[model samples]
Target: MPLQVAPTFRDALAAARRPLVGMWVCSGSPLVAEICAGSGLDWLLIDAEHSPNGPESLLAQLQAVHGYPVTPMVRPPVGDPVVIKQYLDLGAQNLLIPMVDTAERAAAMVRAVAYPPHGVRGVGSALARASRWNRVPDYLRTARTTLSLYLQIESAEAVENVEAIVSTPGVDGVFVGPADLAASMGVLGEQDHPEVVAAVEHCLRAAKAAGVKAGLNAFAPALARRYLTAGADFVLVGADVQLLARGSERLAAEFIEEVR
Candidate 1:
């Protein structure tokens, strides 16, 4: 019998018919990854960019969450072709590539995730888990069709070129990074600043207008809801580190105040 590949978070995002909520996992721990995977999230971002997760750590985390229903989306430190190749080979079907500034870059990323005659992703031998160690037959041939590529629109320049970037063929979606976008617009941490909000909203609208999926990393519930209402296909509501820090701080603060 042949392998049966299930629908991915990317497939849902590409459909763009509803809102898919997700979270960021920066802890790089399989324990933490498994815990979050049980939280009923639609997807999870295994952040190798800001997190300490190298390829090995990412592989472990992906394995930890393999039994869950949630899809694991990995973000490389940078959107380099070689880096993406390794992640794809490790069984990551959904990707959030960072710092994409042009349609050319987005197109390149699309090719990076595809096999020959479609893109330049290097073919690996039977050593990759992506093929289930030879379990997933013809993985090289079918990978291009199942792989979902979401480019990160994190800069003023990227936001300016949002429409063009969304128009790139094989680019499944675009994720707006408000933090970097704010910094780019001269508002270091003011993601809620009217200017930054406008830019993010513009990108969201642009993607939707182009009939492509739009998503964002909005940590605040109200903010995330606002974007979803404005037609975002998916939104990453929070990060593991933020939840741990805030929850721990709240727990400790209550005790400290009671002792005082």
Candidate 2:
């Protein structure tokens, strides 16, 4: 039989034309991934960059979330081709590459995710879950069609080159990382600082003009809405760790205060 090309989350995201809300998964727990996947969010990011997720862990998380409706986007530590290849082979169709600073780097990420004659992704689908152990027919030939590549603009330099980065062919979207952008602007933890906000807005506008999707990772709901209002195609409102911490804290405070 020919490959059954099911419509992926990337397809849904591109067609929605509305901000797709998501959350970060840094817990490296398949259970957490499964829970988040079933939460009805548009997408979920399996973070290998800041978390202790290795290939095995990523595979488990991917499996954990496969049955849900949520799209799982994986982020490697950097935009290294090797790391990207590993994640892709492990069945990550959507990627959120980090620390992209220039058009050249962004272009490299595009190439890294594709196969030969288009890019340099190594072919090993037969041995990988990405092809369902060779069950998803013609995976190598059609994988690029379903792949979504969103580069992170986390620095002042990246903000300056936003136009070029978003205009690079095959880039699905641009993700503005306010936390790192704030640090790069010398404001450290002040993501809402005027300068940082300005930079983020600038990138969003640039992406809009370039006809590419824009995204943001903002913890605050109000700030996330601001980005969506400013034309962000997607936004991450929270993380698994933050949710756990805050919920546990609230629970403890509620009971501990009763004893006092």
Q: What is the C-alpha lDDT of each candidate?
A: 0.89, 0.89
TM-score, structure 1 vs. true = 0.96
Please give the clash total of every predicted structure, in order: 0, 0
* lDDT score, candidate 1, position 249: 100
- Sum up the clashes in candidate 1: 0
Worst 10 residues of 1 by lDDT: 1-10
Give the CA lDDT, 0 to 100, for residue 245 in model 1: 99
Residue by residue across 1-260, what tens digits does model 2's lDDT show? 34453455568776785679999999999999999999999999899889989999999998999878888888999888998888888888888999999999988989999999989999998987778777887788988986789999999999999999999999998899999999999999999998999999999999989988888999987888888888888899999999999999999999999999
Cα lDDT tens digits, model 1, 67-167, are 79888899999989999999988888888999999999999998899888988999883788787776777877787766788999999999989999999
Each prediction's Cα RMSD? Answer: 1.4, 1.4
- Clashing residue pairs found in predicted model 2: none
Model 2 CA lDDT for position 63: 90
Give the lDDT of residue 75 in candidate 1: 95
